[model samples]
Target: MFFFFRKMNAVYLAAITAAFFMVACQTNPNAKKLDTGTEGTIHISVDETYQPLIDSEIKVFESLYPKAHIIPTYKPEVECFKDLLNDSARLIIVTRDFNQQERDYFKQIKITPNSLLLAWDALALVVNKANPDSALNMNQVRGIMDGTNKDRKWQLVFDNANSSTVRYIMDSINKGKPLPTNTMAAKTNPEVVDYVSKNKDAIGVIGVSWISDPNDSLSIAFTEKVSVVRLRADNGSDFVKPYQAYIGIGSYPLKRGFYFCLKEPYRGLGSGFATFLGSYEGQLIIKQFRLFPARLNVVFREANLK
Candidate 1:
């Protein structure tokens, strides 16, 4: 009888232990239930430089589906990447694609992030309407960027210290050289336009969308305040602004590709939004903004008058 009781007690304890672990395994304390992506909410990070265009896209996306909720956070390019890598954000929109090292790191973690080319974005240089010089070549821009130019009267202003515009100048144009000492950093793109508008000598580097679409009120206001600089080609033959034709034809020297990187493993909200962004409607929105759509064909119409 004593042996029988002892064996029964052991069996009871084992059953209890198994049940505890089973419950714990089913409900992991740290595991969050990711959204199904169709009806639930999700957060997306976008580069601050592309706010005007991305904001318009989101407004249309949410209006089509009443059940879905999307919260967009706009920050500097580097911080946007940080939010994505830390899992705070499942999607990120910015310039450029992932490098080999980034791909390898994602592979190690068993996550192959998918990306889409959304549009061709260009950095536009704006100056006060009062400024006499409205055209600049790569050399003049480079000189202003690095503070070695003969024209000390021109002051360079950027969106912010961490903006992709500054990164592009430093990494691509200046070959990783330091920025000029006379540079100013504004809190946002609108501020850049405002500063340039008020200061005759201030030359602001900004994303073209800030002043591209005439339909947008902000863009109209921006155009009223500043003059978009016509950039001279390296060969010195033609001068063009960040107009759609120039960006599409690859003549705009300060242009970059806007892309979205999504890391959702399942067909969640991320997958749905990514599909939408590359779809016809999304591309249309991009076209309306006057940027070059990456996934769609853009037709320019001209009437010949004899």
Candidate 2:
């Protein structure tokens, strides 16, 4: 009887040991979560145009959630999406949604992003500070881009190849029209500004957020070097500069929404950040960017109403 009891006790101890090992493996640090578990570092990638807004937002979020750290990578708008698709990033802050082709590409990879339109922005055209022109009508702008009308010629400049301004000009102005081979491309917006400032015929097209708010030191510096261009309809009669008031009132024709692309709904820190952006504080930041906030609020700007 003692021998039999000894053998049985040994078997019981072995079973407990196996169970403990299983539990330990299940909680292994490198183990994949059963449900895409949380508590990992939040990797965010954003387009250069939204660098100011998103960088500031991430700082605020970190203050709110100390344990959550956001590693933000900045790239051109097109490259930002590429990073998300390639799994280098889990979140994307951009100005537009993925079209059908992009959606299909993600589907091929079995990764679907949740696109959240966080705020609205408008593309602004800028010229040298010494240039007297303050505005260009949509038609004139298109004419210059399409290379159809030579009289409206200006040395059009663009940001990096993957920038949102390049995309916008392609979509809104070119519209499949063959562009002139003479247009120049700058490596960066600052380069474009420098080129425009030095040349009388140069016009720099950039994301409005770059200079939308004049309060920032960088923005003020840019304004001192280059003048923001406005758009008018038809024959340059109703010239309108890109502004929060103009975009809010639908007077700005180039307004578009910025989005937060996520892989999941409200399951992770991405959702929390999105929620905070939709809140009052986020709207305030949007207002500060000189773009229309998601929620309606009265913003004051000096303009001639006549």
Candidate 3:
């Protein structure tokens, strides 16, 4: 009888231990195996304007690390921030960093979010091939944005109403003023190009990446559909296109920084990917996309020709 009682007690304890581990696993899926820098899966959000560049980044990253999988959702910058705040995304790539309120909220939650300036991006103004006005100075650009230009009837088109490009224009160009009453909103950058291609009087605001990739057939097609508008600064004499060298030299009129905000508490896949972006290889990819790389040091030299 004593031996039988001891055996029954051992069986009960083993069952209890099994149940405890099961409950722990259910509570936290990563309890059994924690995600590391080079391994595991993560979800991230990216601004739609950066889809082309980021797609290449992810493809290379996954190929390098077969154990790591990153699922990304492309949306507007505002929506990307919403995903970061709601804990739906481990990282987000957008035009700006976290504001004061966002930093405060993360502090309150005892989470320190990381922000990295990845590259310098340019906003390209495109018009129909038949549109004769393919160049504008700062004053004319502002007038068109604010609906104050009376020289010509222009229709302004944007990728989305809440996109980062619109925000940049309102804050930097328009000086907190509202957009024009007749401004149109296309669903995506490609759609904006399409709209401008069809409307001879329309001007489309899009990211340079959409039409800058020389190797991409779609990018070449976009350039064929519309002509990129040359922009002159308020005090500058020459009109310049949004070339990578112009952006690097501060000659481009419309430029913004690309950033990544990460919410991972541990050194997980998010941190790994962010590190990769700031690495030498990653910056090379960015430069190939015709954007000025922030992490890589590039020198410009002037030559005297006869």
Candidate 4:
């Protein structure tokens, strides 16, 4: 009888241990995988134009969650999209969302992507500190882009031939027209800035984030290297710089959407990072980068002085 009771107790203990592990597995399905919402490692792609801002975001996120590791590949926007489509990356940060065709393809594959608008980013036109032509209207910009601006014959420089900044100029500014023969590709934003800084006649077209972070020493140095051009809207009378308030109010002429598209089927690190970007803390970081935070509500009050 003692032997029988001991055997039964051992069986019960084994069953209870098994049940406990089963419940744990059910509670955290990601335990079997390497990644979860708040833990593990993941690879993501980001547009090189937003490298500065996204770098800061990742640093903070990883610091807060020590076990979460995000490896980001910064490349052209088109390449980032390619990484997403090819499953090379679980998340991508770019200036636009998936088009209808991409959506349809994902639907066909039974994958639903989560795309969130992160912020409003602006393209900053930078010129040499010696260059006096710092302000331009919309028409003038169109002329410069299309090689029709005989007024100054300014040499146009872009970060990359396939970069979002180039696409923005072609689509939004040039109205789908081809870039002029004079437009040069500098490979990266910093190179564009460097080129423009050395060439008085060259204008570097880059994302505002490259030079917007007042707290970053590199950003401050970039700002000091070149003069950011003020842009007058097509209809507005005032020429405004790419300040956060200007971007928020649509006063900045070269503003574009910043977005994060996650292709995670589960609530993994990609989703977690995406949620963080739209959260108050993430939006605050975006604000610090000087981009207009789309997820945060900011009130602009008018104050008058006597």
Candidate 5:
């Protein structure tokens, strides 16, 4: 009844530490370390945008491999990257791969990290449930980000200035234009959702996983408070929400890749966890949350837009 996708690039895999895999995995002699194996405590820095999906992934992984303890430290994407740089984090889940600057820094240190693109993620615009304005086109959203929008009543809300969501809008949508001074900042993604849920005049930018699955209790609760705005492409006429199919086919205009960067020199808990996340079971969790899974063969579907 379950469909398994192809294994991810071997760079992301680790030896299945014994007494952990109900199913077997061949041990690699070239693996990084021998002592830690598959089961051990690990601290990971994760972007708050992926807290929901990663939380689900961790729960399932821990259930299967009881000896593993993955302690996730959720923060803004920028902070997560900083954690990795200072050697405070062994693994991190974020929206992007290493930039040239980061690569150069690591190269100077003689450490080339193994980073994997795990899945596709989207930036969702949320409005109050009572608000009627629920759709935004590429130009319109760009106007809001670049402070060109004529409407003064609508205020823009963000997770954090240093967060990837803000950077994506600034770099991708605003095309390097600076944000307006009036932009609002919340501590985390849930805060953005909560703020939009209460403020009809505000548009909250958040990750799609927070509200993509209607059957999810948290999604239902978020839906009760706010509505996900439909987005139209730069040239397209029809608006599409950040649904799985929309993201899969590239219809969702604000989609980005979800990645994992591991700093383990040997096959440690960090490597094991990254392997689990990119594995079939890991990709399934991404699919269940309505994001496009990188490991699976996906067929995009079109649905009626709200």
Candidate 6:
């Protein structure tokens, strides 16, 4: 009777231990360690243009790791790189890649980042929905940004100072021509949207990701207010628009990749967040924005591939 009782007690304890671990595994892989550490702070710097998407990504990350707190700092795309070089930040999220010169500088500094390509986006040319014109060829866009075209303007085409839209248009399409002297300069994209919304002659250039994701409230709102411009091969090959579908399918002519450049190996919460953003979960967040998630396979609408 004594031996039987001891055996039953041992079996009960073993079953209890197994159940505890099973429950812990079902909750979160990090849950067991949650109480072992106190609060941790991390700083993430991102370009203003990507603030919206990066903000969303960070939110999702926090939800998964409740104890982690991240403070995000926003600056211009160029300035974000400047901060990284100065060691003021551990991470930077931006729309462009490091140029050859910048890459060489990093090599000299002995800092090679573990880069993660987050998603694919495009520079878009937008006109007021009220405008009669809805399409622009690459040459036409180039002319507007580089001042090579005389027909584009607020007085003639639409007046808006070349923001990133104009800058990218010039750099990518025209190489380096100055924007038309008559271009109007709006302080931000929203201002551009507002100006174009009210003025039929005005056109705006922006990133396709800004208005592509209908599920994202902010993106949908922008799409509802402005008209996205379409592009075509001047030889009448095909008319391409800035829809996520068109861009994903490689039909859009102005696509670019978004990247994250970290200053060094992460040490704490920043590292955790970085790993999360570069992980499968984080890439899914990118796909949710209607941009093509990179370094991970994500499915989009069938039209996106065509």
| Residue runs of model 2 more than 4 Å from their true location after superposition | 1-40, 105-112, 214-222, 234-237, 295-306
| TM-scores of the models, in the order given | 0.85, 0.80, 0.88, 0.88, 0.83, 0.75
What is the C-alpha lDDT profile of model 1 across 1-306, one tens digit per residue?
999999999999999999999888789887676676567899889899888788888888889877788889999988887887889888988887777887898999999899888999888999999898998899988888887788757888999899888888898788977887878898899999999999999999898887876476432233778999989878657888887777888888888888998888788887888888899998888876767888987676887979
Candidate 5 lDDT tens digits, 201-264: 8898888887766366432223556888889998777898887777877878999999999888
- Per residue, candidate 6 scores C-alpha lDDT tens digits across 81-105 of 8888888887788777777888899
State the displacement of the C-alpha of residue 172, model 1, in Å, after optimal TM-score superposition: 1.8
Question: Cα miss at 286, model 6 (Å)?
Answer: 1.6
Regions more than 4 Å wrong, model 4: 1-32, 216-222
Backbone clash count for every predicted candidate, in the order shown: 2, 1, 0, 0, 2, 9
Task: Evaluate model 4: give its lDDT.
Answer: 0.90
Candidate 1 C-alpha RMSD relative to the actual structure: 5.3
The lDDT values for all models are: 0.84, 0.74, 0.91, 0.90, 0.83, 0.68
Which wins on lDDT, candidate 1 or candidate 6? 1
> What TM-score, to 2 decimals, does candidate 6 have?
0.75
Using TM-score as the yardstick, the better of models 2 and 5 is 5
Q: Tell me the alpha-carbon RMSD of every candidate.
A: 5.3, 4.5, 4.2, 4.3, 13.1, 9.9
Ranking by lDDT: 3, 4, 1, 5, 2, 6
Weakest ten-residue segment in model 5 by summed lDDT:
1-10
Report model 2's TM-score to 2 decimal places.
0.80
Q: What would the per-residue lDDT of candidate 3 be over residues 1-306, giving only the tens digit for each residue?
A: 999999999999999999998888889856657677789999999999999899999988899999999899999999999999999998999999999999999999899999999999999999999999998999999999999999999999999999999999999999999998999999999999999999999999999988776476422233688999999987778899988888888888899999999998889999999999999988887877878899998898888989
Give me the displacement of residue 46 in model 1, in angstroms.
0.7
> In model 3, which range of ten residues has the least summed lDDT?
213-222
Q: Where does the lowest 10-residue lDDT sum fall in candidate 6? A: 154-163
Per-residue lDDT of 76 in model 4: 97
- Candidate 5: stretches off by over 4 Å: 1-37, 214-222, 300-306
